[model samples]
Target: MLVRRFKKSLLVLSIAASATVAHAESFNRIASFGVIHNLPEGTEQSQETSPEIIAASEDGNTLVYSDSPFEALGFVDISDAKNPVAGGIVKLDGEPTSVAIGGKTVFTAVNTSKSYTQPSGYLMALGLQERDELVRCDLGGQPDSVAVSKDGRYVAVAIENERDEDLNDGEMPQLPAGWVTIVPVENGQLQCDKMTKVDMTGLAEIGATDPEPEFVDFNSRNEIVVTLQENNYLAIIDAASGKLVNHFSAGSVELQGIDTKKDKMLDFTDSQTRLREPDSVKWLDDNRFVIANEGDMNGGARGFTIFHKDGRMLFESGASFEHQVILAGHYPEKRSGKKGSEPEGVAIGQFDGETYIFILSERASVIGVYRDTGDAPEFVQLLPSGMAPESAVVIPQRNLLVSANEKDLIEDKGPRAHVMLYSLTDAPAAYPQIISTRTSEGTPIGWGALSGLTADPAKPGMLYAVNDSFYANQPTIFTIDANQTPAKITAATLVLRDGKTAKKLDLEGIAADGQGGFWLASEGKTSKEIPHAIHHVNSTGEIDRTIDFPKALLANEKKYGAEGITLIGDTLWIAIQRPWKDDPADQVKLLAYNLKTNSWGAVRYPLESAATGWVGLSEIVSHGDQVYIIERDNQLGESAVVKRLYSVSQDQLKPAAIGSDLPLVKKVLVHDFMPDLKSLNGYVQDKIEGFTVDAAGNGFAITDNDGVDDSSGETLFFSIGKM
Candidate 1:
């Protein structure tokens, strides 16, 4: 019995270690292509564009995606996988909903409907090599998804004919009814006259008279599976004869341990039963298929489900996938009230004899990879995608996976719509550089928007980080163990005031008080009633005291204040984010408060001038005799040119009165963070907000994800080695 117990313990340790270490084979992002690059020469660059559904050519050298906002089809040449070139866009007569490739031809489903009541569309085929329209078959309804059979003999399109949400709160039964259209393909050409229309009315229990098909997929047996998202129904039809083979309710799931409130907190104790209104379906084989439960109208299961062709539930992800997303710090807390990390797209691929399943989370902007093990799918790794991933296409032959990200943040001046590429390689996963561990109740410790970091005074590789105002109601200090490959967040301590979670604190910087306490810097916006103050919290996370800025400094204050805090002897130094009304051009204040004297003074820090946007200080940390600061710009992607680390000597700590002329400190370049940001193969992030040096003298940096709001939800945490 003793030997058996020892062996069991060893097995558990082995499994845990394997999970933390790198896998022999994994997927890493190789490149990212912005769909705006495919805009025509005469088109305005500022115009909005979105890549909704994507397809790859047979040779795997070219990619075609539907740009609905531009009303065109865009193409990309990936002959050089690492550097994709624009193949330009083809103008279309209507909005292209989806696209599928068959040999040297591409079939696109175009929505020509003028209104919800009068629905009409067509399936247009164009030559991939010549870029010329070959044929068009009137689909007679608004189509949503299009798929070509594995045998390349048939094409299936789902005629959604969706209802108007303004009509009756988006309720069903207001439609002219939807159906499935299957067209024959002979000798690699679409035969428009031989299209078959399959009637799907009165087949579903909900909205029986108005069936709205959302997505379609084909199996090896030439059978098509259709998802009626609003009706919460699934139907299987024979593509060859247009006969109903089987149909069943998509069903509901009892979800537990989920966040169901938009209260800006990561509470995962709620329970609710919701319908699995699946959006995208893909067949694993002729016998089984998978559905992404994206939910619409009245339901969203918040995960994926697998079902047998005969309607047996094989596996239900429930809240497991969302939990993993929470651990990765990609959970969209703003979407907590609705479908948390709504799984909307699913793709299946067989690479080197191993079948893998890719599930795209629409809100979280992350892809969850799983290996199909016949009975149950095993969770693999999560890949960071562009903002709002809408569809995915896997090129197994080239060991490549591509995702179509439909969000174009042109209005917000954020990252544009992008299509990201990843390749399977013999290396470790490079994302989620930091992840949180489970709590005592086995629930993931939810964390995001890590705005500030401070190293534990005595423990090497141990750090504490604080979230910004993005999580306003649940101000938290996360304890991270950086000794692991992917740094692990071990515990979360909520910043509480009088036994309740603190309110109105926009915490951005943290510093160890050296007496089992911490000093927090809260950036304030007076317009929102938040004050620019410093808070002292006990080891138990209870606020003990608050220090407000002097009236002299407040006279010319801006909303961007006190971005970072650090302690040196009896003085606490703060780095202001941007210039105030009283400050000179290209300079910001680094305020100093003497605890012993109870007085405030200031020094001016010179900022690098940016060509496009303004530059500002993000973080400040004191190590040995140097004070390191993180200086960055507000630009993203290729426009970001200034994300660097600089340091000033502690001897330059002389400060003058708040209204006096502040002494300008000379800084020496410590490092350039642009290369580090590009090392992940993602677009350059704008906020590199946190930096700290551990007891062992190693430097670590982190980026804020803005709580996944209009962002990619990728929190990059990495080390700069000994500093």
Candidate 2:
């Protein structure tokens, strides 16, 4: 077993600056957003910006972030190298998410929101001091990625704006006006002052929602290449005049979250998701570029593709890249395990000059690990775990690998995921095996525990995991013996409203109190679909005989998707992944539960990034004053290989006990092993499902998936800190 350990926060690996970028700097590292999930009762999480981040910043040095408007840029100053201080953030008329720095000036690709028009151009020239302001120029609606000219004379903006949001009646908005705009900048300001916009209204006949012109960039000769979100043709525009040159399409990339073969905790719709329209087109060196074809545009992020500047194919993401499965049978034998095939999530890691990918395949019930060599990915093998595997992460800084698992029964997949760990070592086989534990249901209890696993901050041999066993089939809680051999017996017991198994009850999220206790939360079972709520069950793993969560969040399934739970300082944070149709502005609904006052405050925010399938918010964890939330795709439960990791401010979940002296939970992904890894090159992979953080700030995750044979149970182990 290869020991997978969760790394500590601040462990960032810098990407050596490349001279090929011509006007290139470096990738942003640490991005410590100053917001908190600790919203008050009857409120939502505090969020300031909405421009979703096109890329997450790592390395804790430079910041590659997308601000509220939808533009991506880099920040130079970071605090503690690990604890990044929002040193400098920039934005313009367009939202900032993806940015490329040339020389000292940063070219940002931004797009306006639905209620507006006219995507704009943003240019920034960093002075010797690194202080800069944004110079905005009109680009067009919903621009694609941006590229710079080697001659430093022009900046190309890809415009694929097909207004599809406002259907007037019910028609999908398709901005047939696909065009490329060339705006010249001298001294960091628009020199042309006049943007040369190319016209592409022809695609409107195809009926793609706003399938406008996209992929604007200059070739080696300074000629521009543009592609649309819809259609196969790449439209070429005259770089100098911004005139339409030619149109053609090679193939397409598939956009997805993680590999399904590795993860087994999420809800899937059909057998699986297919590739959809592509987004995020980047030029790979001058001739080749990479495009992420978001299959499930609704945040499904399936896979990606590489293309040549002349509309030729380089490579596309493939499930069959380097995978070799044992072949349960003629067609995968439908893994038969106690835990049904409830797909977990997936994870991607960059280490040892290679990309380590993992997934949780609950049905086959194995944790899969793989490696992608940039050209193609290859399958490694399948590890064992408890029942179902959910979510996992790999943080190299701390040299740790953690997974969260839960126990439950649904459909044929068998039981829910479980909590497991593996200590990452210098060697490959150091991966830890699953520590078998007996569930509270000892009647030869078929499956294992539902998961919301997290490492403890205060104790050495302890961990807190959650389950939905206690409620009317609702989620519940559990505690594991961290020091026991193979993680010892479940010795697991968690309190849920009177400690009775009520039908239709919901208990999913769990976090450590930093002292010897734990925090447990539950969603409303079935009563009028009471809004999801948070509960601060003590460390004894018992439910609080005192407070009520429903009253605290005033949660309603209709408005907010308050499904996931976590704790950051004194605040108990709840995640609302689904926004209410009536209230589109509600980006994040986080209820800051004050541990001291034991009260709830409201801090709501909107998001520019995408979301999961929006079933039940899965789990929440805090690492280094930052809060992380886990969301599932949908009910079908098709575990993808990787999971989505987002960061929130410690101020949001202000753990009431911290006095300016102590630190909030600080944990990060060091290693992630799960199911369904073949998608990423690993065979025997399982889905990683849940996540947890203990009092000591260490991290742990639970993962599960259908087994390849369809009759086996596999779980793996992963840990956070020294304990």
Candidate 3:
């Protein structure tokens, strides 16, 4: 089985590589619509809002999404595909869980459950143009997913009377068993009185008495397929007659080459056999469907599976999709123990003449696109998405794909919930500007949180990067071949001390020591026992010597220590991330340590004043006659104002004693990184942390994805051309 899985992964890589080189028609993000923008006038923007499940009008000109936190249905005008405008929101009586559009009416499943023991909800039909409630059918349970029939004759809602997690540890059999509700629609009007409740009790091996129907979808045959998430089951019902046609266990999968430990390391040598507690179900055709094994209860297969609807598993993705995610540097290492990547949403779209399946990884914040070949799906490309994409809608006529991201980080002051737009065009995929190649054992080189970078002196397009404290247990230097289109991480060398993996080191900066070795800077957090120091390592990744901060500097050292280091002649310069205790408000130190003299001195560098957050240096590199530095603010998205590259002349290397008044060096604005960060249409990432100029004088930079912890898991690595 392991050999088969390995072969499948290799095939996927080959297909992905071919797709990239052949310039195959791909989907690229065009714009992002923040759900907060849909709030009405005078409404506070800081309030939490989310776009969970989305639906589009028949004309494909407008979008409507369910916002449960705000208890409203949000809309957007996407007629201008490249530029989306807020269409305001309509207040709803209950929390909208899912939405679907049929003809001129919008059908929404609203959960009004008073409690899990007495679950209740309603299916609301509203006028798409007038935004008026047309009809409301009491579903008698908390609704989760809603789907409209192809002929616009029926609407199906999955009544998921979910269990309270606090009770019995969220085990099944929490009574008031859920069922499927089918309502007839005629002439854009819902016949609520004719709504039929399809009983779903005694259908699964697990939770047979309490069937928690999670998601619903309809095929061309008017057959409703619903996933019983906690029950680990699936059932098919005739929408017209509301009769059960078939039911079966969602089954289990034995996963290989997967990371099963959340030890702050990306080790993919573990294996597990888990039940596929599928979350979202989408019909590929009348005879087949796909399920995202999100694994709510005791099981999550960590991938997706395709079924023939006749109780036969056609294709199980296993860990192939997660492997691709690992290669793209978007793997969520923290989620390894639960569900790696966590495929949560599945979307099927028929664009032009080809059928494409989009598998959304909620934890990784990426979508895997695959071409359905009727037998086995062919791997295509991965699409970068907003945080925690819960659902997606495809508009074939407009060649557009939309994802409703459900995570709103307003409380953390991060990017808000977003509705991301992608278009199918005759071009190559633009995302994943950096990816990793496989090891000799055919395992992906898992990497993230690229905090610092440096170029090889004699090798053009060859660079090295270090992962920060996010993976504190496994500090590594990744060799990058920037000559590739999406620069490839060719190898990963673990930084070791006494033949053991180094610990408690927050490697934030790296520079080649000119003798096939490297000089590394470890940013210290006094509270965490990691010291502010520098280390010299050979090509074999073994630390030969370590240097601690001088007494004068250590006395005033802050958590924000050395962020970047660059070697120039006999001296090593380190860029301090933030101001120390004795420094001026708007100035940070650029410390210099001479290898031959064995001493330390510093010069202050002026910072660009930020309107909101504090600004600091992230990276520093020496090229030609100048030293390039990356200065950025801690703010994300629209609040960010300073993510720039500045250069200081090499002749300005005047350093004084640490306690003495330091001379401030003059800086020249080399480039504004806002445009490059915005090129992929994602919200501007705040951590433009790594920068380097190769031997060819080409400039390259990267952002730290924070190890996909509360982040979108997008590590943007792009070149700014020649320096």
Candidate 4:
């Protein structure tokens, strides 16, 4: 009887532990609102637009954001929440720097500066219910940030007499020093005549004469905390007295294990001495405040810091936040030489009796969520945002968080500036579809641009993936465990040639050889001096041998060369990406190389005709007597049409000699990938570069992030089930 009871208790404990682990809190992206949609009907949709800073109405059903490029303030009606409607835009007389909402009243700081030395701006109030401007007051200098007190008694403005970067390389002390403005507000009405300017000079260690106040926030005690970003200073002012209470240098930090080069690799062994030139500041509580250290001229600590009101240091992130970005595959290798990950915006709010902090990385386009523990904040999770999320607003009452993204890539024909919405709930997180675990030495197995995938024949959920030319100096193949909820990369192998890391190899396809080696397809570019070749690499990633195409095939090769490879017995099949010079219109070649005969042959595959863009094959995989290939168009977002999987029978894959007439193969559409791409509610990504079937016959697909170079860096790795 005692033994039975003990076993029963152990079973109960195990079940309870599983339930507790499954009930953790999470935030998942719910909707995305493009700022371009807020434009008036007569305006061109292609015009550059941005949502730099944002605020929400009292009821949390409406949002207001500042768009500096169009010199206007935009609004979004989130009454439906998941499906936001355009609430139109309001044209302002000057550039709207920042916005805040008190009850139903909207307040904006407009920068009307004629020059850096001759600075000017105004504080304007507008009634949201009336949809008109209520009052305007001339602020002493150009304003950058605006905040309202918790008691709704007053408003604080950071008048940043900004400096011109072209003049003297933007070294400060350009005169017309900046200061803080305090104005009384009674029942949603601003009393501008009672406004007072608080001088903040002779304080900072650098540029003490010119204090450029960058951001401001009000504490529960009606005190304001402001950040002098360019001056590397933080100041506190009493709202009632308009007198400076305390000030301190934002300080510097010694960073270890950081990537500080734009050398096409994600190596985190370097170090740097960085200044915490914070861009955004927020009060976590009455005693502690947090800052997003986004450096300008000299320093960016690449993380965040927490400090007490009495100038006591509480906590410093110290490259930890940026390291999380690396684990999520959102590290911007291109910005390694500058401020890595560039934490530019911060927001503090309470939910379910717990205070949470949100830090936005402008370059990496991700948000780090943390819980305020009074001492060192506890990291919760990472959220994917739109390009360059400049500001965030949290509506805890409605369990919603919004981000204002400021990047508009109209010229590059990429995703436009957007306002993304996320909701905290019991649902699982939809982001970080793929992540890498830390190595034994505490370094991340850094990876991105996963171009191809092939499953291990014997392992149930194990698969291998390869990187493209994005990491030119670090060609790698990653081993992934797909049984995990969000598939985790377990290990990495460097592709080596002659015992050295391979260079200039654009690996686009992988196929497991009958032996313990693999066949890799290189998508070559003549302009860049990369060759289109089939390389056989052993299990340890050593190049055992290579095969180049014959003269008949090479004579008509284009930049879009071999994309995918598959092995069937002694024959190897390669999928040509597009129609080469020698192929018929709207047809690509399935070039075959026979290892037993040492000869090359080809067969044509019909391409899907797209209405807006050209369609081509991305991958080829052989299972049983059938071969599956991915065919997609180059378009992205709503313009995408043809991302699908097609299959062909092996009996019809007979290939002729490369110099002779080629036979066309018939293909049947197996699956349309559009629904999978739209599952997360984000804009559809352009590169659906990888597809494979695990040993269990479950199909999987992944998209490339381009190493977060002008990209959102959201890798969608998910299972499609048995194919």
Cα-based lDDT at residue 163, candidate 2: 51
**What TM-score, computed on C-alpha atoms, does each candidate reach?**
0.97, 0.43, 0.97, 0.95
Best of the two (2, 3) by TM-score = 3
**CA displacement after TM-score superposition, residue 363 of candidate 4 (Å):** 1.0
lDDT of 3: 0.90
lDDT of 4: 0.87
* Candidate 1 local lDDT, 76-184, one digit each (tens): 9999989999999999999999999999899999999989899989999999999999999999999889999988999999998888887877777986999999999
The lDDT of each candidate is 0.90, 0.43, 0.90, 0.87
lDDT, candidate 2, 1-723, per-residue tens: 000000111222221111011111111111112211111234332223222222222332333334431232324333243333434444344455334444456566655545425433343333313545556565535555566675666787666554534356324453345566687766655564667766666543344345555444455667766655554345556677766655545343332222243222221111333432444344445565554442212222233445555655556543221111121110122221111232223445555455555555433344555555444434443444433343343444543333433222333433322223333334333222333232333211112334456666666556655544322332334446656433533444535456663333355556666666666555554445643555555655455633455432342345334455666656677655555432344244555666688665544444433343333345566667566665433332233333434455666443332111212333344343333222221223333456655555655555443323332333434554422
**Superior by TM-score: candidate 3 or candidate 4:** 3
State model 1's lDDT.
Answer: 0.90
Candidate 4: regions farther than 4 A off: 1-23
Instruction: Evaluate residue 34 in candidate 1 and report its C-alpha lDDT on the 0 to 100 scale.
Output: 88
Tens-digit lDDT track of model 4 for 1-723: 000000011111000101012327888888998889999998998889989999999899999999988999999999988999999999999999999999888999998888778889899999986769999989968898999887889989999888888889888888899999998998888999999899999999899999988999998898899999889989999999999899988888778888999998889989998888999999998989999998987999999988888887778788888888888889999889989899999998898998999999998999998877766677778898998889999999999999998988888888789999999998887778888877887776688999998988888788889999999899888999999877888898999999999976999999887566789999988789898899999989999898987888989988898888989888999999999998887999999999999999989999999888688999999887899999999888778999999999999989999979999999999998999988887778888989888889989999989898878888999988897
Give one clash count per candidate, in the order shown: 0, 255, 0, 0
Residue-wise C-alpha lDDT for candidate 3, range 344-388, written one tens digit per residue: 999999998999999998899999899988867888888999989
Rank ordering of all candidates by TM-score, starting from the highest: 3, 1, 4, 2
The TM-score between candidate 3 and the true structure equals 0.97
